[model samples]
Target: MAVLAAIDIGTNSIHLILVEVDESTGATRQLRKEREMVRLGAGEALKKRRIGRKSFARGVEAIARFAGVAREAHADGIRAVATSAVREALNGREFVEAVRVASGVDVRVISGADEARLIQLGVSRGYPLHGRVACIVDVGGGSTEIIVADAERPRFLRSVRLGSLRLYEEFLAGHDPVDPNDYRRLQRHVERALRPLGRNLREYGYDVVIATSGTALGLAGADAASRGLPAGRVHGYELTAARLRALQRSLLRMTVGQRRRLPGMNPRRADIIVAGAAVLIGVLELLGRTALVVCDRALREGLVAEFLDERLERASQSGDPHAVRTEAVQEYAVRFGAGGEHERTVLSLSLSLFDQTRALHGLGAADREILYAAAMLHDIGYYVAASSHHKHSSYLIRNADLRGWTPGELMIVSAVARYHRRSMPKERHPEFALLSPEARDRVAKLAGILRVADALDARELGVVDAVRATARGGALELEAETAQEIDAELAAVGGKSDLLAAALGMRVTIRALQVERDVDQRAVAGY
Candidate 1:
């Protein structure tokens, strides 16, 4: 069992969720949840691309208090992420450092795309997408993330700069009852932002539209209250477009103080509820759907799901660490149309080389796994274009949402694949430079091995059944067991062994051994 806390610092508020996870069964129970409206992006913060002094202080204080609560609960781990507000602010890193100093908690500022993916992960826990393609929309304070996905994976993911607080502050603030002109401008802004998303909706139609985050929950709660239904009972609630329109109209006509007095209303959200309703209603109309399913699970819940997933993955690593990673890599390779016998042959050779050179490289099983994944995916860039396919392969590996691999691991794997054919890891290369010194060294060593393995399969005929490496003094000699002549493969190795030699600080040489055809055939068959 493990206790975990996830905190989401947003433009309008900061949220915390404490979950107890059963490690053996992979079950999670919500222990507690908390929210505080700090308006971190209040006033001209978003407009100016900075957090205001007051908002910054409020955000720090709230995070410190939340950290205290998590510590009191004896959470095994706490993960905090800041969304669009801090992500876009110029001084966002400053705020993050301040929170770290005050609360002793590290905060990760995620990209809008990652935020969308996590939201979908969290929503899947509460509401199953089943076999249907569902468009999950998270109406956040600084941005809106839309993901079109099914039971398996997401098809489309996008983050628009439209949000309740963003729209409210940009167009509807300072108005008692929303000005008709300002309302029109807000609608126009929303329409423009959602136009591309609407195209996706038309292209990849959804079976259901799922809405998440506080804005959606508040809108659903308000709709339920107006219909004389139970209050705060909005989760899994199917809020219809017509009801949302009705509520939007009512909100536009009422003052903030009046809206605050309404039953089931959250006074903190009163001012921006109108804009929130507008964004949701726009999405519903675009989908041509009657209603949206409300999911209270958003970024914070997504964080919890992620924590549990990582924990479960770690637990599995003890038994068979490569099982999940291999599956995820193979799945991605197949998806990109890069899987075949040639890739299999290269993968086999890469692993053999990685295992054989363990003493020289001083890399462990984990590094071998990294080499395995990179070898399987090194040619994936051919899916994009044969020219500069290596560069394309790097991009795909970095961007593809492969499970069981952390962001850092993905970087290393991608770097290894990238350098399999092209230039070595240089400090000038942006992607290589971004990696830590340790990761950069790992990539260099692994890529050096992968290049030689790939070269051994240069003909894609798997002629070289196996290679035995001998390290003598400062030079390494490879004996290739094969019946057929391998002049081409030998030449390929000569060109590719430069990296390996440089990485291992040794001279490298390879030669093929010609045995009886029957004996060679037996060796190959055994391999």
Candidate 2:
């Protein structure tokens, strides 16, 4: 087991966790935990500036305490991050510098998308996520992280500034003027800002709605305990479609003091819990999810889990480049909903050609990895935009921040995706030249392999089951073993051979082979 510590300094609180993780199985157990209610958003609304002296000091003190917990745990690594309050405030830099000086911990200020991605990572790692389209909503003090995922992979991720602290500062300013008109106005603003998001989320219809963060978990935990449910299984705690509506009405009727005194309600969270619940209710209604499942894990656990998972994957990989590349591509293909057999066939063929023509292409292991990745993710862009899908693939590969991949490796994958169809790499293209001379050469070579492989799966079906490559004289022969001869796939492969020939300086020969009964035949071609 490896120990990793994560500290999250947010607008409302500072939290730390010491997690003991089993690297081989991706199992995580929390050893120790600590949190402080710093209220870093205090007076930000009245001042229209940032967190003031008292709040900043409170945050620094919290960090100092967390540093002690991390050290005592003998943590192998520690990740300290700050969210919306620090990112939005003018004096955030000063506050972060203070924490660094006081606690010797560098704080990473994360963007909203980064926050949402991390939140999803944490929740998915902690839960049993199998074949469900999970929509995770983390309603925090300064931001709300909304991530829509299909099982273990993220589909749509976003973060909004509609949070408990922001709402409290805007509407619940003074207790005296908390009139019905003021409440109605706040409601209209929230509904309007959410309308655009609601419209865009129609295609990504979610099956299970998972709520995370302290406030969301508290609501779900309290509600579940009220109904005589299990304790920690608050995660995936179901609030039925009808029950949730009633809860919303009940929450709106209760005052802050009344909420504090309610059974299972945390006194510290009573003031902002209403605002958090409102946002979650809005998202649930918009997404048409019948029940909301609460997740106890979120951003902090995500950071630790990621570190643990990487260590495990590296240990399992055992330094085989081919194994590592294949594992990565296979995981990605499964996550992105690509046909597994089709990807395997394409990869087998592309790698064979790459190895056979190494002298012609003059590429290395890295280049081969790029080719495999491009083959696996060739259709991922279809998930985002279809018209200019190649370009979309390039953008996503470049910017998605995939783990275990270097920037140089990502560039090669992006270039391969870009050149798979329509346009080829130009002399003046900016991203193309960013690669080193050796990498550029590898990109051109691997792009040829990707183009041919992707074209072979034009129908997006698992027709081609196997492939082989052979070098005869000055020609390269590719033989594909198929259950049936896919005419369209062959036509597509034939069209791409001209470009492949121009780039690889060789004649391309392709042929289909047949099998009898269950016996698989070896694809054959000669030059």
Candidate 3:
């Protein structure tokens, strides 16, 4: 069993979870977990930037404590992610640097889009969705993530800056409010901002609302207490739309100090509970639902599930010989920002080119996997730096703790991507040396397919309709259909025919086909 720890550094809290993974049996179970509300965004909220004083110190202390616990738990792996607060802070680097120096932990700052996806994943794990269209709302101290998920996945996901802490700061910026006008005005603004979600809500035809984050859980706790409910039973608790309205009214009547003393209200959340309740109230009213099903799990669980899924797939492929090559590559494509359609176009061309000369190249499952991952992650380097982007892409893929990929698998993907551009696999490259002798040879063989795939879409249009492999004579024929004239693409391929020829022992011809109209490109890309 491999023990893995995931640390989530949120604006309002820091959480650590330790879990043991059994690779042999594909079993995972949590061992230990701890959560602390540090309010890392406390001072930053007033400055509109990160203030590396109290928040930074608190974060470091929390991490230090987590490190001791992780060590005692004997964690085999560690993964840390920073949420909206750190991402928005101008001096966020300083805080991260301080934490790293203090606790020896590297933190990944996930984008808001990624945050939304992870939150949805976490919510789904705790409460499996029954309805096809569901709205996932995570109201945090610094940001609110709303995901409109369909039968397929999230259709529209957005993270708004309307969090409880921010609202509290705005409302209490001055002296104590003389009347309820301040709270009412904040409610109106929140409703106005959330008006756009109605468009997607109506479009998706949603039937269920899923609520996550501490705010909802706290609300559920309070409501449960009011109704004489038992503790530790609110994970799947449902609040009817009407019940939620009544709770909001009761909470609104309390002052900040009063809210702090309420049952289930954390001392750290006293000032922000009102604002969080307001945000949820707005969502409830807009969706025309009186209650929401509260889920205790959020992004932390989502991240862990994603990690587990990746590890499970990797283990499955290791055990089975017939696993699909596209499984890993498509995931790589998603992390690399490659368009699904383009990746499919590239995959089709790559496989077509590989199949035509399999007799000479002798491509195996592992080789095919390398080809697919390379094709999927070929453009990831563009996100970091465009200049000499092939090297950048290699660096990013090699360093990224991509789920479902081992260090060796990441090396192959990186090496394949490295050769996707001008340079071929060199014997002296560090990444090439890291692979086993068999893998190094495979990388060289697979790089030929990647180079060809990269050149096939030289025009960057979704025009490459289909690719076919035909070996009639001593030569291999690569035939593809394009919507428009692909002279540049052909020219690009023309330049790389020799690399393919050298690897496959025969010259390759690139041709444009005109007789294909049956294939669904969308399905091929999993879109």
Best by TM-score: 1
Across 29-90, the per-residue lDDT of candidate 2 in tens digits comes to 45666677777886563246588788788889888878977888888888999998888888
Name the lDDT of candidate 3.
0.70
- Clashes (backbone N, CA, C under 3 Å), per candidate, total 0, 0, 7
Clashing pairs in 2: none
TM-scores of the candidates are 0.61, 0.60, 0.59
Candidate number with greatest lDDT = 1
Better of 1 and 3 by lDDT: 1
RMSD of each: 21.5, 18.1, 19.5
* Tens-digit lDDT track of model 3 for 141-181: 78899998742357779998887777777764343321388
Tens digits of per-residue lDDT for model 1, 1-527: 67899999998878888876544333344567777888888889999999999889989999999999899999999999999999999999999999999999999999999998888777764564424578999998898899987644678889999888999999998687899999999998898889877766789967889999888988887888888875565656898888889888888889998888888787678888988888888888777889888876778877886786676566556666445666577668757655443565576667767768888889887787788788878988877888888889999988878767887788888999999996877898876989988888788899998899889878664556567798987899998776556788899999999889998999999999864321100111101
